[model samples]
Structures are given as structure tokens and as C-alpha cells.
Target chain A: MQITTFSFKRLLIYPVILIILLVLGFTVTAEKQPAWFQQAQDEAEQDGYKLITAHEMKALYESGENFTIIDVRPEYEFREGHILHANSLEFDLGDKLELKSDKQAALIGLLGSDKKQTIIFYCRSVA
Target chain B: MGYQNVLRFPDGFFGWKSFFSDNTQSVDTIKKLGIGDVFPSCRLVMLYDETDRAYLKIQSLQKSFALEDIGNPYLYIVIYNEKCLACVDEVQSFKALYKSLNESLYLSDKVKLLAIGAGSKKRGVIAFKKENAIPYPLFADENRSIFYCLGNPVLPTSYLVHIQPDGRRQILFVQQDHINNVEMLIQKIYSLVKDMELPK
Candidate 1:
């Protein structure tokens, strides 16, 4: 009887150890998010910019909604390819929405004094 | 800045192109270059000098070189975009590999490193070369001719080609994405080419 009891306990402990090891392996192999990713999330929240996916953007484009889409990549990249009806406005690296005086004027010109206009800005990636 | 209902498309052009079917002819649409494929012949304009400085226009730097002209036993072609920050960041890893090759007595003379800036103009290429202090030869593919010829690969694609004495060439290895570890890659290439005869 004692032998059977010990055998049962051993089986239970084996599974328990296996489960612990699996969990540890997963934790070790899990990819850690980059620092910039978290910072971008925080900035988006603080700046009140809504993040939309490609599908959502497609839906918005197909819905014919009265919205302005701007391609904020470099001129060459914009020339290479961009979404339909998206205006070109190049932004330097890491200069999200920080437009210079002339660029600000250009943005104002594209936006046309309407504070309620639905505007969207996109670049090479979310970064 | 005062727009209240502003939305941001995080996926940008690449994601949009991938999801939707539009008139935009993106480079990603083309098939990626893979192993067992012959490297395409394209003209590459040299933009940077040996000292890593941008060559002035008056320096008469309009000369271009063909891929077939580089007579090295092994050629490491790194295709990158100067405007792409991620691509620029990946250059450090290539630099490490270059340093390793230079340090290796056997591979130093046999391997040649070359960088092609896809969709990159001379000015941007110069600035990128200067900023990174890249020691390798930098070429600008402003019109993306070479990029298109190579199947419009994703930014930071590297191809390792083995050239034979009879002018036959074949891609030996390809790294289509960021290389996380240089040491492992060095060891891998070393093991692959350790027994190969050096070019005469």
C-alpha cells in the first residue's frame, strides 16, 4: 500500500514539475516589447490620437466618408506608393506632428481652416 | 494639432497595400529573390568615397559599376533604404559582420561587402553613409532600378553570392530580415566557406 501511495505521489510530482518547466520555458522565450513601442502607446494615449488598423482604414476609405488622409513619408516613398487620394506631406524621422512653420502652413492649407475636419496621418510604420 | 477627431493608420502604406487591392505598384508585389537565383545585372552609382564622405558633384563621380565587374570569390550585397529607420538601424549588424570578415585572415580577401540603397537619392545616401561611418562601398539606386531588378525585396535584405572562376554565380545564402546575432552568422559563414579554395 505504501509503495502504491509513493508511486502515485511521484506521478503527481512529475506532472507538477513538467508544468512548472513549461511555464518557465514560455516566460524565457516570450518576446519582450521594445521601449519605443511602449512610449508610442503612451504618446498616442496622451495625444488623443486614435490608432486604426489597415482593415479599419480600408473600411473608412471604402465608406466614402468625408475624411482627409495624409501620407507623411518621404517624397520618394510617397512617390513609390501611397493610398488613393492621400496627400503628401513629408515628416523627418521621429517628428510626428511636429511641423515647421512652412510645413504647418502647408498642413493648414491642406486642412483648410476647418477645425472639425477629420484628418488622418500615416507613415512607413507605427514606430 | 487642434483636430479632435484625428485618426492615425499605424500600418501605413505597406499594410494598406498588403490588405487592399489598389493601383499602387509597390515593390512588395514582386516576388522576393531567393536562393538558387542568379543575381540580376544592374547599374549602381557610387555615392560615397573611401573616406566615407559624400562625393561632391564636381568630383565627377558619375561612374557606375556592374555586379559582374566585382570579381570577388564571395560578394555580400546588402539592400537597404536610406529613408527607412529600421533599415538604417540594421546597418550596425552588417558593420559587425564586415568587421568580423576583415578580422578573419582567410575570408578578409575573399569576401567583399557592398551596400545598395533602394529608392535612395545620392544626397540621402551620402548623409546615411556619413552618419553611420559605413566603411563599405555605398551605391545609390535612386530610381530603384537595381531594387526592382532584384524583385523589390523588403528593406535590409542581404544576399551572399558565391562566384566561380568561370564567371558563374549563385546565391549561397540570403538573410531577408534583421540579423539578431552577428557572431552566430560569422561562425555559420566560416563553417560554410572554410574548405573552399581561395580565388587565384
Candidate 2:
């Protein structure tokens, strides 16, 4: 059987085309972030959620200020080490912070549990 | 749902360790730390090479990899991690101070320096050290056992430890939080060490 150079070159075209398509697809997907991200941030802002730094939080804790700290990290991470007196809740699935339908009610219940309390959500690092 | 107020601790647990001391040592602990107060030393994990790793047994301002190994006595120990942005700057400043003071008393053999990266994996810290071009030997404490052992407190804490001729370990000075000026810090450390040597 004679394997021509032209035939070998033709065989390589399939992989080349596949690689180009894969790169283009990856670029398109990478450039676009999750649709729910901006919506969530807007919702949080509309709900009067304010951002605070760790140093400020430390000062508040030192002064004996009353505040509810919600740890949004995983249960295992919370168990490992979390802020003192902070409550833990897993608000993530895989990589997305999707508010699953079942968990929504529990979240609402938590928010409504304390009417006069100030609630703050905290994670390892804010991004 | 709307909430009244919300705040986040950006620095988190690591930052908290830098700001406050554990039950053993409170915020006022610094004032109480003098010649007689013994500095607790523990064995901490450190990354030396790609494959070879060992536990750094730090006790009385001395460091050793193995129990039978001879501990290298250092004049000071700087505990930091890659997570702390300020620590990066602090390390750079230390390098600058070290170079600038090469011919001075501050950078003499009498003042041996050792840096330890607390609570970070070896891989991450290695990259950090490489990028920073850190002149001093860097160690990684993958497990925060050393932090807890030292009683969790603020990070980037520098201890000026002195091993007297009589083999007594005493802390001459302790600097907490981010240091902006390395020269000033070196001066301060020198003055503190000199004060310790002064007769009462």
C-alpha cells in the first residue's frame, strides 16, 4: 500500500480544523461570564447589602457589636475553620452560586428568622 | 429579601490571626513579653526542594530539619504567608534593608534572619518566592499546626529572638502587622536588641 504525502496532509487537516474550532469555542465561552452574576450583584445591592473589610469586622467584634455572620462556604470548610460565631450555609453547587429551588425557602427562613438582626455573608476571599 | 446592614471580613481567619492573639496571649501580651517570658517553639513543615521536604523544628530561636540535625540559631524569625499582600512588600523591604546594611552592624553575622511562610502549600509559596526573588530561606507551613501551636494571632509578625551566652532564649522585640519601612524596622530592632543588652 502506497501512502502519498498528499493523503497524509489531508488526514492532518481534520485534527487542525478540530483544534481551530475548539479554540474559537473556548474563547467565546471564556469571554462570557455567567449571566446570573451581574443579576445577583444587582439584587444584593437592591436588597441593601453593604461590603465590609475584615479589619472593620475585627474592630466591630472587638467593640462587642451585635451582627450575624453567615459563612457561605461549604460545610466541610466551615467545620475546618471559620469566623468565630459565624453561621454556615452552602450557597454553591460545583462552581456556580445557584440558589437551588429547595434551598431558597431555607434561605428565606434564615433571613426572616431575625427581623432586627444585621446579616453579613462571608467567604474565604471576595472576588 | 432585604437586610438592615452587611459587612465582610475580607482578610478572614488569617487576617484575624495577624490582628489579635489567642487566649494564651491577648492584645496586651506584648507589654508582658519581656526577658523572662519564654517563647513557645514548635516543629513546622517547610518545603526545601522539589521532592525533598522536612519538618523545621523551631525552638529557642534555633531551626533544624531533623531531630538529630544541628539547629541553626537565628537572631530573628519572620512569619508570613503569600496570602498577605503586605507580607510580600515586607519581605522585599527586608531584602533591601539586608543589602543596604551589608557593611553595617544590622546585617552582620550577629543578626541571622529566617523567613517562614505560614499556612501555605509548598508549590504556591515556591512560585511566590521565585517571583519576589526573596534573598532569605523560605519555609512553608502547609498545615497551620505551627500557627495554632504559637497561639493564633496576627500574621506577618516578626520576632527578634536572642539566644544568650548562657543558652537562654528570650524575645527582644515583636513587630505586628505590615511594616512600611524596612530601614526603620531594622533600626527599631537594633535599638531593642541594644536595650536588652543594657544593664539596668
* Residues B80-165 of candidate 1: C-alpha lDDT, one tens digit per residue: 88767778789899999989988989778777778888877888788888899887778888888877777767577888877766
Maximum-TM-score candidate: 1
Docking class of 2: incorrect
Each candidate's interface RMSD = 4.2, 8.4
DockQ-derived CAPRI band for the predicted complex in model 1? acceptable
**CA-based DockQ, model 2:** 0.15
Model 2 gets an lDDT of 0.59
Chain A TM-scores, candidates in order: 0.63, 0.52
Off by over 4 Å in 2: A1-49, A52-68, A71-127, B1-36, B42-74, B100-103, B196-200
* Candidate 2 local lDDT, B1-200, one digit each (tens): 45556655444454455555351111222222433444455544345532222112333333335212214233566777776555665777667755654445544645656667777787877887788887655667677665554444445676777766555556777777566777787787667766766797
Summarize candidate 1's per-residue lDDT along A5-31 as a digit string, tens digits: 999999999999999999988877555
